[model samples]
Every structure is written in structure tokens, then in C-alpha cells.
Target: MRSARRQYLLESALMTNPLHTFQAWLDDAKRHGVHEPTAMALGTVDEHNHPSVRMVLLKHADEQGFVFYTNTESPKAMDLDHCPFASLCFYWNPPGRQVRVNGRVELVSIEEADAYFNSRPYLSRIGARASRQSQPLDGYAELERAVASEMLRYPRGHVPRPKNWTGYRVIPQMIELWKERPFRLHERLQYTRTGNHWTEQELFP
Candidate 1:
């Protein structure tokens, strides 16, 4: 009965815009108490053509692209630099819904990156410059010392975004939404980009 109602609502209330629908689903997930709703699995290919996946926090999403920040020198960032194509998968437990995006990656602008970086907490800003992501460290104490050292360089309210830290935008070519139903049946809606517009396809679960 719950599945039937959900299916009914999905069909009746489906938005024409995939990005809008994605934002709506995210809002719904937050209302449903899904922790860290913005967390997503980012998939990329390294220079050697090996596939890699990591969890990244989604900063923003719009018709333009889905955005996330990271150290530009990290392994994942290096992978993206070698190959611009990538994918993002987002799953919400309560609603049992998943969103998958496949597209080419591009770097966000310096001004834009600076604005978002400035919005983060001071400690987080310090951490970005303190630690070398994916690099070896002596120990937790070493990391703590590095953080402390970084903190002193830029007092409380004024930490500049590190040069190695910036944002990336995934220019989605295809977006798919999966809605789970009882008995293992699911509904999938896919949107493919066609120039400036989108073409929709319904897939069998």
C-alpha cells in the first residue's frame, strides 16, 4: 500500500526539470531525517584508466552543474585532471531513492571558489591548508601540530582559501533517478541532454 501510494505520487508530481526534481528529492530527504543528504559517491578514471570512487559532499547543484570541493592535488583531483569524465551517485535511505549523474568535469572559477571557501568554518579552512590530502603523515599529533601552525598564520576570521583547494563542477550529460518499490521492483527515470534541452526515458527496473 505504501509503495503504491509512493508510485502514484511520483507519477503525478514528477517535475519536468531534472535539477529541480533532484533538489526536491534532497529537500525531502532532509525532512525525512536523512543524515548528510549531500554526500555522494564520485566516480572517476585515473591516468592508467583505473576506475576510482570516493564519497564527496555536494556543495551545490543547478542547471549548470553539480558542484563539490576538494584539494586539487588529491588523487581524485589528479584523476579528474587526467580524464574529465566522471559520475556521481546519491542515495537516500528512508525514501530508498537514488540519483546518478554522468558527465564531464570542469573547474569552478577562482572568484566563485573563493566565495564558497570563505563561507566555510575557520577550522575547516585551516585544515584545507594544513593537511596534504592523500599524502602520508607522521601521526595524529603531527596533523594537530600542522593545524595549529596553520591556525596561527591566519588568525580567527581571515583564512584565505588555499591555492590547492577549489571547486569542480560536473557538467551532467545524463541524470537518472531510481525509485525503489516493494518486492525488488523499482522505477527509473532518465534525462539525457540534447543541446540546451533534455529528453526523458523511462527504464525498466
Candidate 2:
């Protein structure tokens, strides 16, 4: 492909507000009932330099970055504690679009977590308290019993948020948006944050 042609395609994407463009796609995905459209693969590294990735729901996203809830005592949390950098990739296969973000990890404000927790179902809140995430479980019956016990303990269904379960926000430094095209070519646009400004660039596929 001619460099000029490629650059034109890239310019088309860049000239349009990247944030708004991508957000529009996300909203469309949600409206189309894309299964778990907010879910992304979260990647983190441990102290020993081993990398781990898992599908986590993207609970929040904006100029500040992305946020997701998890057990603070889980393996992922341990890894985050040691290495506060992470990456997130969202793939909307049906729409043939993808977004990748690299960012530093930070614990979301208590207020945010509390509000989200309160929005959860009563039974879900109880289950969050009963399950010690990432920990070995004896059996399904044991888990059910634990949940039942916790439910009884909070008969009013006003379960408090678990101290060990909270939210983490990723402060993005770089974000990439990819779109599928014909002839084995793909469109890639990236936005990088440096200090107070954002820089946009195009990558060849």
C-alpha cells in the first residue's frame, strides 16, 4: 500500500476525536447486545516476571482510564501490589474491532467501590462475602453452605462490601484502536498520553 494512502486512512481516524469515536463503538456494542461487551482481557505481571491474563469485566472507563472489581487477596491483586502496571484488551469480534490499553494500576476510591457494590444484587453481595476468591474450595456444597450462612447473617440483604473485594483503576498512558479492513489490511490508531497532552499516531498492520 502507498504510504500516502495509508496515512490518509489513518488521518481520517485521527481527525475524528479518538475518545468519542471509540466510546461510540463501545456504546453500539452494548446496544447491539454484544455478550459481555464490557469485558476485556486484563494482563498483569508478577514479581517473578511471570505474566498472567484473565477476562475481567470493564466496570468503568473514561478519560481517567478503565476500572474493574476483584478480590484484593486474589493472585491478580498480589501481582498488582508488586507491579502496578497492567494492560487491557477489548475485542468486539462481531464488530471486528479491538482496543488495547496500557496503564498503571491504582486502587479506585472507596466511594466508587462502595457505590458499585451497593448497586449489586443482594444475593451477589452475600456471595462476594462468602467466596474467598482464588482460594481453593472444598466443594460446591461448602460454598453453598457458606453463602447460606452469610445470607442468614444479613437477613435484611444489606450486606456490607467485603474489605478484601474492591475496584482497581488503570491510569492509561497508551491506548490503541484497531478496525478490520479488506485485503488483509487493518486500520490501527493509537493515542498516547504524555504529561497533560495526548499524541495520536498510526501503526501499519
Candidate 3:
């Protein structure tokens, strides 16, 4: 039934705007009570050309592009430093929609970072500061100590965003959306940005 409805939407109107369609899919995911609807797979390549991928939450999305926060000291950070390009994939089960985005990454504004950091849970804020992120630690005790130290340093309701804790925006050059269909057949649609305009194409699946 879900696939049938989606197939009708795909065949009839198709999406005119990928961003709008992406947002619609996201809304559908939330409505279906899907867990971690914001989660996306972030793909990056280091200077050595080795590829790495990890899951990251989608913090914000707009005409500017997709935004996600991270610790700048992590391996993914180094990869982005060497190569600014990134690919992102988001999948939702009940809605059975997936979105792929390829883009160049840029640091988000300090103001945006500060606001988002402040909005995080108190413990999450402390955890962001406590973890060295990709650095070797002595043991689990060391991690606990670090967390305790951070709590004492910030106290409750006073955790501040670290300088290394920042956000990045992926300015998309291409966006492809996939909708699951009956059997093994699937539906794929792509949008390529040309100047300020976008060109859309349906793909074979």
C-alpha cells in the first residue's frame, strides 16, 4: 500500500524541487515515528584517496544546503580539510525513501554553531568537550575523569561550545532521491545544479 501510493506520486507529479521533496520525506519519516530520522551517512576521502564514511545527524537544511555538527579534531575533520567535497546519504524505512547529496563543504557561521551547541542536552555539551575525539586515551577511567572534569568546569546549565566543536554546511551540486517500489524495481530521480537553476532527470533502476 505504501509503495503503491508512492508509485502514484512518482508517476503523476514527480517532485519539482528536490529540497522541498526532501523536506516532505523527512516530515513523513517523523510522522511515521521512525527513529533517528535525521541520521545520514557522511562520506569523505582523505588526501591519500582512502574513503571513510560515518553516520551524522542532520542539524539543518535549507537553500544554503545541509548542515551537520562535529568535532574538528576527528579523522573526518582531517579528511574534509584535505578534500572539501563530501557525499551524504539519508534513508528512512517506512517511507522507504533515500536521498543522496554531493557537495562542497564549508564551515558554518560561528553564531549558528553557538546556538546549536547551546541547544544540545547538558550532558551532550559536556561530552563534546570531554572527548578528545580520535585521540588515544589511557582507559575508560580516563574518559570518566575527563567527563567529570568537564562537568566541574562547566557545572550544570553552563556548558559552552568548544572552539573545535563546530558545524559544516554541504553546498550541494547534485541531489538524487530514491523511492522504494514493489519487487526489485525502484525509482530514482536526480537533480543537478546549473548556475542558480536546477535540471531534473529520472533514472533507470
Please give, for residues 12-130, the per-residue lDDT of candidate 1 as tens digits.
Answer: 66576788889989998999999999999999999899999999999989988999999999999999999999999999989899999999999999999999999998899999999
Give stretches of model 3 more than 4 Å off. Answer: 1-14
Q: Report every candidate's CA lDDT.
A: 0.90, 0.85, 0.90
Task: Please tell me which model should have the higher TM-score, number 1 or number 3.
Answer: 1
**Model 2: residues >4 Å from true position, as ranges?**
1-17
N/CA/C clash count, model 1: 0
**Residue pairs whose backbone atoms clash in candidate 2:** none
Models 1 onward score TM values of: 0.94, 0.91, 0.92
RMSD of each: 3.2, 2.8, 3.4
Candidate number that wins on lDDT, 1 or 2: 1
Task: Indicate whether candidate 2 or candidate 3 has the larger lDDT.
Answer: 3
- Full-model lDDT, candidate 2: 0.85
- Arranged by lDDT with the best first, the candidates are 1, 3, 2
Cand. 2 TM to true fold: 0.91
Give the C-alpha miss distance for residue 21 in model 1, angstroms. 0.8
Ten consecutive residues with minimal summed lDDT in candidate 2? 9-18
